[model samples]
Target: MLESLKFFILRFDRRRRFFRTLAPAQRILDIGCGTGKNVTEIQRLFPSLEFHGVDLLQDSQVPPFVQYKRVDLEDGALPYPDEYFDAILVVHVLEHLHRPLRLGSEIHRVLKKGGRVYVETPNWISLFIPSLAVDRSQMQTINFFDDHTHVKPWSRQGLYAYLGACCHLEVEKVGTVRNWLRLPGDPFVILAGLVIPNRGNVASAIWNLTGWRIYGVGKKSTH
Candidate 1:
């Protein structure tokens, strides 16, 4: 329920900006597409483009335009031919895997030459202060580690290095989001000290402090 609500609140456009940079007619693959939320948004945004979604859990609600496949991304190969997709969306999913590099290599294999891939992961470096100040009980309620089935947390530099080692992809962009308060002291501590008790205030503080999340777009080398 919370996950669904979060998806709706984030809206599709906020996440699709990188993907929309490509020309129309590019085939897109969405890995770890939970509940088909983003897939539906993409369909509405690009009606003519082809979209494919894959996940371990099969949800009947998958959008009509999105062809959902049940598969474990941690396994050997993605169930698709080489150069099957021109663009891939991996929003907040790479952090959950045990072997992300292997999966990245597979993503590289399946993408067409000059294809683009957008990847996102929680900014662990940004979460340091917040995770420390917030009580574990409160933190657990927030599900910071729940959906984070990921084996290890990631930093922008760490992710770029790993992806670069796995494949000949260029790191186009790297930055954080959701932080807005720009406070001097620990934003989480300051947020926890607020009187009115703004829920989003903490998130904004984290973003300002740590760049909350890290996103990057990479293009497969044509060579």
Candidate 2:
């Protein structure tokens, strides 16, 4: 239920931004496509489009529209030839990668000219919750390694720099996913905080902080 809710809130925004460049792609590849959820969601939005997914596990319960393959991206190259895919999606996958740059290069090579890559990863800065009076390093460490497979968290700037450099892709947008739920009750929280010193700022800042998850879309350089 929680995962589904997260997906529901995130899906529309992502879909809107991602498909802005290529509304209807000829062929798309999804790297690290665990269960092909992204692919399934995208296929629903664009039913006629061709979708392919590559992940370490082959037991994904993917829909008929998606062609699923098992590939260890950290060890081997992407199976497709250069400039084959019209677009690619790499959602929530980078942190688990041991060789993310290599995958980025492969993504660059596989995408057709002007193709776009959409990526979302956990934001390291969000791990530090100042309001809760948590230790920064310890909190960061906990969040960073919450998933045992995660190599490291990526800051928004770092993600842009690495992907841009590795793929020569033009960055479209890079920002954190604001906590939408926190927005509505901020004024009340602020009011309450005035009675209690340092409470308002802490309450309001939670929503104002743009550090939950960093996401961006980049287009392959045509030249």
Candidate 3:
């Protein structure tokens, strides 16, 4: 039951929404794909679309028609020709980059003009919310640095600026997602929503302020 609930929350996450948006792309690349889990799910929905996954670790259970490449992104350039992919999914991957600009340039190079690039990163605000954390220690640390490898924790605005500056991509959508309800704080929000008129919007705004993930969708410049 707990796992089911988690899946329900995941379905509404920004990454899943980004996945849905690119269902029609003829070719999709999943960078830092980590076993092609996301792409495998996407293939279940759109099986005809070609999928490619690149990660440092090899996946043992890869699906058919999906190409998996074990590439050390830190050491070398991605092995695709310029403008090779129709869409690129960078979900929860940017923060791990040591040279985000170099990879950003490569992403821009491999994606066709007018193609979409979906980026989802941890919201800086989530560090302040304990319910968003997995343990007491994480809450105390309060920076989502539990992994220690998350070198870049971006806000929605930061995501927009980085993509615009580095990749020269056109920003199409920027917002928060997985703005789930918390314990004490959300109960009050729910109460306010029930008692006051148009206060639901206010409550929603509050939750968005504390949302867990910052999401961005950008288009490769047609020029």
Candidate 2: residue 57 lDDT (0-100):
71
Q: Cα deviation in Å at residue 94, candidate 1?
A: 1.6
Tens-place lDDT per residue, model 2, 1-223, is 9798756655445444575445658898988877777777667678788889888775646566778778897874899888999998888788887778888788888999988888888788645643343333333222445446778778989889976898679998888766565556555655564556454254334534445577878898888
> How high is the CA lDDT of each candidate model?
0.68, 0.71, 0.73
* Better-scoring candidate (lDDT), 2 or 3: 3
Q: Which runs in model 1 stand beyond 4 Å of their true positions?
A: 1-14, 126-148, 178-209
* Alpha-carbon lDDT of model 1: 0.68
Candidate 2 TM-score, true structure as reference: 0.74
Ten-residue stretch with the least lDDT total in model 3 = 132-141
Tally clashing residue pairs in candidate 2. 0
Q: Write the per-residue lDDT of candidate 3 for residues 1-223, one digit (tens) a residue.
A: 9798757655665667677777669999988888678898788778889999888775675555678888777753789999999998888888788877778888888999889988887888755654322233322223467557777678888899878887789999888775443333555654564455344333344444457577888899888
In model 2, the runs with Cα more than 4 Å from the true position are 1-12, 19-21, 129-142, 179-182, 185-210
lDDT of 3 at 77: 78
Please report the TM-score between candidate 3 and the true structure.
Answer: 0.74
Candidate 1 residue-wise lDDT, 1-223, digit = tens = 9798545545433355664565564688988888777667667677788888888875575666678888887884688999889888888777778877778788888989888888778777643544433433333312246334646567878778756777558777665544232335444554574554543455445544555577777888888
| TM values, all candidates | 0.74, 0.74, 0.74
Q: Model 1, residue 154: displacement in angstroms?
A: 0.8
